[model samples]
Target: MANTKEIQNRIKSIKDTQKITNAMYMISSSKLKKARTDLENTEPYFYTLQVALARMLRHVPEMEHLYFDSREGIKEEDRRRGYLVITADKGMAGAYNHNVIKIAEQELAAHPNSELYVVGQVGRHYFAKKGVPIDIHFQYTAQNPSLHRARVIADKMLENYENGDIDEVYIIYTNMKSSVVVEPQMIQLLPMKRTDFAGVPADVFHEEITMEPSPKAVLDRIVPNCVMGYIYGALVESFCSEQNSRMMAMDSATKSAKEMLDDLNIKYNRARQAAITQEITEIAGGARAQRDRS
Candidate 1:
């Protein structure tokens, strides 16, 4: 059993920690709200891009480009796969980071020879410990997610894919739905395929607009932009999900701390009362014995 002073100090320390956790919870909640709104806005743009790209594919049926064609018959010497694993820069978000790492490990289980790209500190650490071969580690100083940062990451993946360092690029991130719901998602980012652009809008589906250079030239430019847009969307989703997870985890911690404080306070009061009663009883006995002797 700890002495009164020791117990009191411990309680004080826990109270201070509880205060910090509560503040963090509030901060996470506020950020989650803003992130949620941003993610919602991006959804429409993603759909629009998908529709536009689908339209382009429909209008150009005879497009004999790698972006629209299959390379199944190509030799194994011609292809390499790249996996981009995105996670939170910090932890304290329950299993949020763990789930992403686990899914990525599972997905890459069969591809030991594939190149790995990591986007966050958590994922980088996990894969590094697992002996995963990382070809690139993207670093960002932003405390929050930025579209520009995401575009840079997109460019890195695109450049590698186009330069033949990677045959296919895949993005792994946590998809945000709500504060309580975050799902891990794995999406292919490269080898720009026509089938990947299946959701284009009907109106823009077949507009035969002339390009300034040529169809191949237009696609070459648009493909990178498309990759950038997709990566930006994924980063937004992953950040939002991280905020939500942190908020939820901190909420639970705050609640648990409150309960523990309540229990400890009750125990301290009971111990103090017991000690006082014992002192009073001893004094009463001493007084009675003295009176009898008198």
Candidate 2:
């Protein structure tokens, strides 16, 4: 029922929106590709280090590294946990930001009185709206996930873990598999898992090695560095996931807007044609009636 002018304006508005979304999609595409390459290159090193540590631990049962230290038997009263929630700094990424914050909410609800460390502005704002207080709000590193920035964040996490402020640390972020697929994940960063190592199945190698500086001393040097490497890898994965999610979201939005504009333009053209035909019929009938009167 809209007039021609009104329909024209609506089409123009949608076209402008489509342009913006298209630009965003292109930008995200470039960033996602770079991030994935970075993640691929760095992840192997972390895996190798973890495998070496696992093999060493198997041979040297006397090793007592804090990272591999077990707190599995601790009482409930002594258990306090920390959460590091990673989200995108900007919006227009569909449910990417929302899903991550929802995951954090579920986690916090399950474990009461947990400390929160937020990486992105989106997560920080989400927690603030839910009346959740953040213990640490890191901005620059979250915006740009590079090796140096990741190292700084990891060192800070290590400091907190060593000081006994938190018993366990968890990182919540999205994992990128490909351009269109991103999976949300919650992984334990501190108190590293015993099973996720490259050298776990190599039993022959574990038995033959002898420690020169002692296994415990080697673990003290290696475990923390390896943990840092893992954190860096996670950061790279998270960065890729964010960009991929945004790119897909924008692509969908642009396509939807184009379809809507096409539909509206069709309707407008039909209405205008109908109006023109009615006017032509009226003019012809008026001329015939005038000739008959003459």
Candidate 3:
């Protein structure tokens, strides 16, 4: 058993660490709440955008647009692909970053010709160190998932698609199903199929509504906005998942620290009592010897 002083020092160190873990938990909780609120506030606008796009597709099933090009003529194996991967800027979040990176690695293995567009420092550095080529590393956007950031990403993707740099685009991100459940998911962003909009509420208007200029012209405007909304939604979901994971990890760490403190306190008390008992015995022995000598 260690001396009382050493035990006391250990207890103090553990207490300090516990304070840091508790603080991290509280911070993560706040971020999680704010992320969810922001997503809720913007959901209605995105829903409306989706409905409009769905209605347009229904109005003209044969509509051909650059965004809808399936590129079926190109071989799947040979077609150039782009993946927008969302990860965390920092990691203390248990397996959150690891899970995302694993999925991204699987995707790249399947699509050897794919280009990576990573949006977090963690993922960017990991892939860069592994010698995996990154087409774009969006800095500072991972921590702050704002509309402006989403718009910039969407525009860049659309420009690349228009230029035929990539035949297809996909987004890989983490989705928070609930506070306790998070899963990494991937969704196709380009070459959208009409069936993808099947979830949009059935057309409310039965009569033909004439688009001002032309259906194609209207679609051109709505498609990019709709794409931006999709990217924003992904960003928000991934951000929420990261926060929730961090909160859980910190909470667990704080609890473990508390347990250690409790065990150390018991040891400290025992050591203190043993020392006092030894001192009392020594004093009693000295008095008994003095009396015998006298």
lDDT for each of the candidates? 0.78, 0.80, 0.92
Clashing pairs counted in every model: 3, 0, 0
Best by TM-score: 3
TM-score of predicted model 1?
Answer: 0.91
User: Candidate 3's residue-wise lDDT over 130-165, tens digit each?
Assistant: 999999978899888999999999999999999999
Q: What ranking of all candidate models by TM-score puts the best one first?
A: 3, 1, 2
What's the lDDT for candidate 2?
A: 0.80
Per-residue CA lDDT of model 1 for 170-190, tens digit only, reads 888888866579999898877
Where does model 2 exceed 4 Å of error?
A: 198-214, 285-294
Worst 10 residues of 1 by lDDT: 199-208
Q: For each candidate, what TM-score against the reference?
A: 0.91, 0.90, 0.97
Winner of 1 and 3 under lDDT: 3
Best by lDDT: 3
Per-residue alpha-carbon lDDT of candidate 2 for residues 1-294, written as tens digits (9 for 90 to 100): 787788899999999999999999999888877877777777777767777787876666565667765577867657778888888888878788888888889988888868998988888888898889899877766557887877777788888888878778888888877667888889888877565553356534644887668776877677777867866777777778888888888989999998999899998998788889989999999999999999
